[model samples]
Target: MQAGCTGCRSKADTFDIAMAFQPIVDAETGRPFAYEALVRGSNGEGAYDVLSQVTPENRYAFDQQCRVTAIELAVAAGIIDTGARLSINFLPNAVYSPVACIQLTLKTARATGFPPDRLIFEFTENEEMADTSHVKTIVETYRKMGFATAIDDFGAGHAGLGLLAKFQTDLIKLDMDLIRGVDTSLPRRMIIESVVRLCENLGITVIAEGIETVAEYEALRAIGVRYIQGYLLARPGFRTLPEITLPGGSIAAAA
Candidate 1:
């Protein structure tokens, strides 16, 4: 850990936490493209149990710890050798300084021998950004450091196209509300198609999240979406990395 990380380390005494992982598979190859690290209680409780304890004072610590723990556990689970990316949800508001806050993460990744290029820092829409400039700095800095950045829950939050226009992100996760029943709804399909097109134009990869059925999955695949994540593939494995099961397609085996 860096010298600047002392504040967060001191604040880390507030809570105990763990992680769960769900694979985000490639639509064409059915291979694990990434594993999103979801927070959980150390005793196997829900995310709420862990997140409810996060306050402004400890937010920085919590965010830092989450990144370190996720990478540590993923390394222990051999995810570093799987050639799959690790998607870690980060609290942009908690990040006081992008360069300073990232030192611990850099140290942890290096210690574990995980590839920095394969790390994806996902910013959630639920966390209202008080300063867009700070958020932009975080994204830009992370990208320059050889890590990918993404906007999570796109349609469900205030930071939609407007925010995307202000900063560059490598990917955006389509919210479940926009994807639910999209297979049967023309309007939903049209909306998703338009979003996909817009993202494609901006050179941002689109990931359809929260898919629950074969119909939804097929619909997304047909829409030319190459990346996907949801219970239809695998649920978050509490303190573990869940196995991925790909739907039958032209590709016979897991890539």
Candidate 2:
């Protein structure tokens, strides 16, 4: 697992970026299970505005800075008060050395007094893996370091059942494509239910993401997706924790 934590030129590139946090709520309790840190331009531009600046020469810097920024911003947003975990997206290809790259994150967590265990590092399946073995090493090393790992956008892009055959993460977020109209689409409902059951059997939790309406939320809850994220709960809070809207038509502010 730790074998791939080598060969890297740690460098920093000059660029401006920030984070917007969106909550992932618990279906049963209507409380935030975690807050996912999304990349944004310093002036509050969307991810594309920031990602467009990434090049092979600066990918490492962007990835490193993202981790540091997410931790600092989440702590500032009072995540500790909510007792919810902080989930940050990472680019596997950019990670030249998982162990080496995480040193700054560990340092930042310590500086902010954030519990290491409350941090989850997730990689999206949308990003194709040039080396599956490298990604697996990163995941295993992260878990061993007591940080939870997740596969984002499961069942979309290059991420699907085939990838799961190699290894399983702590959580998998169902792609919005599958959850878009789950309430009315029988095919989607069946697919979601099957995925939920498969995750259960594999001891991995499932989170239905990109939900937009009451109907979508209700259907996901019925399908046993305990962790939910999307517009229905709350939009991304720029430099603040947004309030969560419960299934019963009540808003619970993140503390």
Candidate 3:
């Protein structure tokens, strides 16, 4: 964290951010396991448009606001009654103190009636984490506090196997690059199949993301990947939850 990152960062925080949600659904059952809150502008802008405003000075505030916004908007979008969990993407570098930074999220959760246990804090492995120890601490602390922690873009990032060996997060979404052409690539299939078994042995749930074609989805299912997230299922809905399109031309509510 930088110099301006202290406490709630209420004074330095100035940007406005909104959320878009997409479901991570069970492959076989077509039931939503969780809905990931993706950052967007107030008027349904793309993530890059919103993330461009985040700077080192206000990074902490942005991260804090993201959590609160995600929870509040998700509840308003009717996630409260659904059994599905809420997965929030977080910035590890922006967190100075785990407990202090999460206070606003806790407050928002309490206010919105979102159960703390139903939230999953996700950080991408693509981010160049300066300190692995800090990330490990954050993950352990969050899990102990009843919040699930996940590492996103697992296989394609700054750290791969080494990071996984250390964190062993509750969930991991195999990178889309690894998933994109798996149905046609034998090596891709071999690697993903192997990773699935590894995750099963390690007690980490594997989510095959960025699934596009029927061949890709079928290939993943054959490899035994249970949770799937991508356009083949549903696209991220701005300020709402998009309905999932299951295989065989059937549609299912994301909730």
User: Residue 193 error for model 2, in Å?
Assistant: 0.6
Evaluated against the true structure, the overall lDDT of model 3 is 0.89
What TM-score number comes out for model 1?
0.94
lDDT of 1 at 44: 80
- What is the lDDT of every predicted structure here? 0.86, 0.88, 0.89
Residue 128, candidate 2: Cα error in Å is 1.1
| Candidate 2 C-alpha lDDT tens digits along 95-193 | 867778889899999999999999999999999899988899989999999999999999898859988989889999999998998999999999999
Clashing pairs in 1: none
Shift in Å, residue 119, candidate 3: 0.3
Q: How much is the lDDT of residue 189 in candidate 2?
A: 96
- Candidate number that wins on TM-score, 1 or 3: 3
Model 3: per-residue lDDT, tens digit, 1-255? 444346356765656778999999998789889999999988888899988888866777788889989999999999977789999999998888787788889999999999999999999999999899999999988988999998899898899989987778999999999998999999999999888999999999999889998999999999999999999989998899889999887998755
Error of 1 at 10 (Å): 2.5
TM-score per prediction, in order, is 0.94, 0.95, 0.96
> Order of candidates by TM-score, top first?
3, 2, 1
Query: Which structure is stronger by lDDT: 1 or 2?
Result: 2
Task: Name the 10 consecutive residues with the lowest summed lDDT in model 3.
Answer: 1-10
**For candidate 1, what's the RMSD?**
2.6
